[model samples]
Target: MTYLRGLARSAQLLGLAVLVFCAFLVTVLMLAAGGMVFGLLWVRPLTAYCRALFGRWLGRDLSVSYRPEPGPPQPDEEGFYRHDSQLYHGPRFPAYFQRVQWAADDPATHRDMAWQLWFPLVVLLVVPIGLPVAPLAVRAVAAWSAWMWRPRPGAKERRRRTDAVLLAWAQCAALLLSAAVQVALLAVTLACFLLGFGLGIVFLIPTGITHYRWLANLRRQVSGWGGGERIERPYQPMVRPQLRGDGLYRVRNSLYKTETWADFNARWVWVWHDPATWRDLLWLGADPFVTGVLAGVPVVAAVYGAFGLVLPWIWTQAFGADWDTWYGAVAGNRLAGLVAGVLLVAVGFWLPPKVLPPVSRWSALLLRPTAKEQLRRRVERLTQTRADAVDAQAAEVRRIERDLHDGAQARLISVGLTLGAIERLMDTDPEAARRLVAQARETSQTALSELRDLVRGILPPVLSERGLPDAVRALALDTSAEVTVHGRLAGRLAAPVESAAYFAVSELLANAVRHGGAEHVTVDIRHRDALLRITVTDDGEGGADPSRGTGLRGIERRLGTFDGTLALHSPAGGPTVATLELPCALSSPKTSTS
Candidate 1:
């Protein structure tokens, strides 16, 4: 019985080996012919077959470790699917290419390919030893397959190290390229200045100064990529020429008939007078020399060390060639030259990650915006926010007026007409008059109820009476979901701040129940560091997009009046959290809670 089982297992192994060999040949041919997508089609079934053979014959489990397939492409607002920056009319091509890239990039795919090539050889070498050694050979083949195909431990760490080495070399290359661009731009700057000031050809001055700004901006952007603080642009805002009542466009004190020369003069003066213009010129002249040294050391060391020293040492010792280089000979000693070469190569690899961050910091000293520019930007922001607030207020007033004219006011007028009718009918028909009075009373009550609802919509009664903390608690009670409120405020907030916060919370709670299908929710309100913070969390189907919903945008506009912000984190599956923050001082130090 034992011999029969061994013979059966040996036959199975022999068949599998032949099948894998044919598959390997086909895969290689398809790959060589530039049909990689078709080639990868062979790897999946081949891996599955190997895994099944190991499990069934040897009773050892082999797991398939291929990465999950990419999901279907999602379309944008215009109903077009986007891959990278290009928009596709349909999802078919994008999805296919995405899968191709996914498979090609997967480490398991490569491992499986390697196994297909090796497994056939293993079977040929070990299976020819006859039936006595058949079971042993099967076990050996299974072990080899398991070792090659299983997920490698510490793979992620290895990948990270590989990435760091690549990034360091890339940064070295980028720095050298930037240095070359700086040298070219600096020459253009001197020529422009010479032409503008020396020969009175002033148009070239602004042209050159404005054009080279792109390079300065690129350096500023590159600083942040090296894991350093971001540098902000320091130039003043450009103001266009405005036509005066006299039908002339004024740039400064000078006025012109047509807008063309006025616009040109305005732009020229704008670029020439700004302090950042000079600072940019100064940075352009200095960056190549200062940052150039930091970037050059690693590259020069790596190139020189590899070709100049290491290869020369190899030539002298291994090939019996003369060592005649000026730098790598190391006093006519080959071993010393080899040691020096290895150390220099190590230095080249180690220096980029260490020095790139400091290079960014040094660039920031000249590239960051100055104090005057900062103040100017702040004023511009405030002016814009104020305008947004005024527009929001006007819209709110119009909404209230429209609601009153349509709802409560119309109901009250009908009630008054019914009362007059009842008075005229009192003597003629007592039963009809009594019915009219009853109808008038019911209509009046309905009108009053509508008035209360309208007021509540503007400002909830609970909010004005008890402040933000208690008001939020009342809100949670009215909601359909099970809601729990945590934390308390030390005192009442300013009226405008409290009102803005109350409505913002109301909007989030309504959205959670209506759209999210949430079963439970939590509201946490606290005052810390002179800021009123409220967080509303719900466990539901999230995927709340502010751009798609008007409720979230209205909440944003309302909060913007008080300089408050709403931050939402709602992923696809469940659990959405909305945080509202408003800066205000607490007044009357009495604890408020529900």
Candidate 2:
């Protein structure tokens, strides 16, 4: 069974390699035809799919998110707008050229291209090496297991028996099961190849895909048994049937816009070099062949022994004819021959169960992350988080500058003009001068109010005075929607984290009222361990996209500073939920006043 399982896994891996190779060829052809710019329309989606596939293979999520470009800036409180004139109104360039330029400029696109170039090398290295190495490795593991479980000279009888039974059952079960699966896969693959030209293509795609999926599942199962952590891929995008075009249109779209071809190219060039792929290749070569040989040899011997020995003796005795006896008179007994056949069949079934565990263990070794790889991944994550923090802080500073310039500064300038007019009028007309003095006083008061508002916008006084819960409560009260707050958070968070959280919540609520057309909203905040979780849910016409809106992107950037994450779930035609998670420890509780 272990041998069979190994063979099945190998077939799946080989199939994947072929698919990737085909994709690479298509991508190259497209690129040569100058479709690289429009190719990105397909490339981005293709990259996402590859990330998902990698996650499945590795048994973990490998999601990488890209921020959408910011849109034109909107007016501030003082009715003045800021714009990047060059970005929006640069010298005339072709639309296709612009798109191509954008794709070339994107780091994600570059990474994908690099992966495409890297995939072939992995396939060339892993396939040939894995085929021979896998079977030997499985055999070595079986040998090691037997040696390890061998009874010691001073071992108790019961202890020896227990160890023997455990070793026997695990090995046998794994082998039998894996072998059965491999034989089935072999049969299916043959059928697909034979019928592929006619009815085969239709069945081949689905069957081929399912075969690999099961192989991946087995890998995950064995890894878990060996104490390896499982990683899940994030949800891949789903096509809505209702939104789909007609058949003709769909085909045209596939040719013109769908990333299917580009996906093929990316997948071909990037899928083979990973640990999961190597392990899968190992399973393909070892499991099926070992199980077949071990189990097949005995079954063949049983049938031949019965015919050559027992059958001749039986015929000679029954017909009263002289015949040479191969196995003495016992070979003439029909009942004995039947009994031997049954025993041989039973042995065939028994062999696999005894051999499977060791092979599975061999595969498991490949699935586990090496200590070096784990450290490398950790360093990469930390580096990215630090960069995001710096960028977010810079953006915040720019925002503060904009607010002060547009709101408080503009109001102060108006007050200064009014005061100057009053100075010119004071001696010429006493009554008019008195009126001017009162108007100037009013103007100065308005300027002071604007400054206060600007300062409050920067950091609300309520937040400093009472902390997050009270500050959020004030925010809810200020909104038009019927907002409900659920869950309790005690004590104070670090000032920057708290501020980011508060504003993130504020932005969601504002979006709910203004863009979402929501009537009711719910804010749930809870602290668990060293992290704070905030969820804002609203009954609104959903379709909230960060790419289309600067507000959500701003919130994401702000939260990124604290190693935080934001997930938006807003499908069309209904409710939206924005979840925020931040890693931080709370400070001592603010003193409560009655």
Candidate 3:
């Protein structure tokens, strides 16, 4: 079976080589029929189509390829047909489509405008290509040509472009060298064909393969190292099948399995397998592509050739002869190589992607996720808050009960006892009974004051009657901190939100008065774009750490329950500002019963 399989593969590859030769003839006939420019015009679209098709193939979600033909029963494999959350949970094709549409490199919009683009290419194709230096076309010409030298953001893409040019030059150079050898063989006898054939097989084939592998390896070296990734071997002889226990049930797998199809066809082929000669023939079909780009592409090639090639030659001729004798130039040759190497390195590396790393790092420095993620992680924060509110109400109820039982009830009992005693004395002293009633009235007044204080602690009366601004003003008036309620907060918030806001403000005012030791302070509230922002700033000896006490901690807890945040910016010697940001989603409930 192994012998038959290897034979079959060899036959397939040889047949593929013959097919490529035939295809090259067909491509030549097609180009001749259409004329070179017309044929050339199609290459960009074909290249773009190939790129997009391969990109889509690559960008497909990674699929697991299960093994053992019909497959083995394993615990992990049992879940293969089961839904993976990453594949199943989120939105479907439309979501990915929307993401791809919003992607920086998506082709959807370009597809919509395709009609507008190809018409110009079609018009240019109908005529002999021109490289006229018209002033109007100068910017377009410069931009398009300069694109080749521009740094692609991904190092892989940059290497692809460079290697493509190198591969073409290598192939063309190989063909010329091989053809020269063939010509030399022709000068000899027909018997030399057999000898020449042997030489080509022994020498040219291996050397061509080595040239191919070197170009392939060079791309991997630069791209992998530059991108800071693990580099795989660019090419290797296929490893034999691994033997299982008892040297039976041999299993063979490709060293690097393709995670996506595009890698298999393009990136994969480069990294592992060498493609057949059909790919080379198809590449030959692209000569019109090269010729057209050279012709219609202005003095782009000329500019690259002149400054990139000719000007350097001219400079060498001009400057290299500074010394009369060649021996005298040898002493300063190190300086010359140093200058040349510096220029070469600059030319090699300086471009757009290299220019942008500083900006990327700067943006990364300014924004951080630690605090925001900390808030997001509190799971049952809302439940804890509502429980606290209930506890506060319960404590208020107990205080009210104690005040009534001790003060009012006791005063009534005393009044009864005194009145009874006075009734006995009523015949003798009616004024004594009146004095007992007056004592009960005084106790009643005290009880009322205590009840009022308890009720206010549960929910302040000022919040229910006057809205946030007025309630805040009342706190400010009572505060020892010379407080200024600065900005106008015109709109009414939902009552619960307003109540939360009111209490937060009230607590701050009380703290400022008692502890902050400030001469002046400012409170400002504003409603903008469905967010209510309240800022309280104080001019104090201000090293106010919010985490030190429950005053700010409780305030933070309240804000977190509502998916809001409080930030404190207080420095040691002066002003302290506390800013609160919250969503204005408060729909008022009839919460007065509690």
In terms of TM-score, which candidate is strongest?
Answer: 1
The stretch of ten residues in a row with the least summed lDDT in candidate 1 is 585-594
Better of 2 and 3 by TM-score: 2
Runs in model 2 deviating more than 4 A are 1-273, 279-378, 590-594
Query: Which ranges of candidate 3 are over 4 A from the true structure?
Result: 1-425, 585-594
> What would the per-residue lDDT of candidate 1 be over residues 101-135, giving only the tens digit for each residue?
88898888888888888988888888777557777
What is the per-residue lDDT of model 3 for residues 534-567, given as tens digits with 9 covering 90 to 100? 8998877677787788888777766665667787
Q: Give the TM-score of candidate 1.
A: 0.52
In model 3, the clashing pairs are: 263-268
On TM-score, the stronger of 1 and 3 is 1
| TM-scores for every predicted model | 0.52, 0.43, 0.36
For each candidate, the alpha-carbon lDDT, in order, equals 0.84, 0.63, 0.49
- Higher-scoring candidate on lDDT, 2 or 3: 2
Per-residue CA lDDT of model 2 for 262-331, tens digit only, reads: 4443332233334444444455556567645554454444445556555655676689776553442446
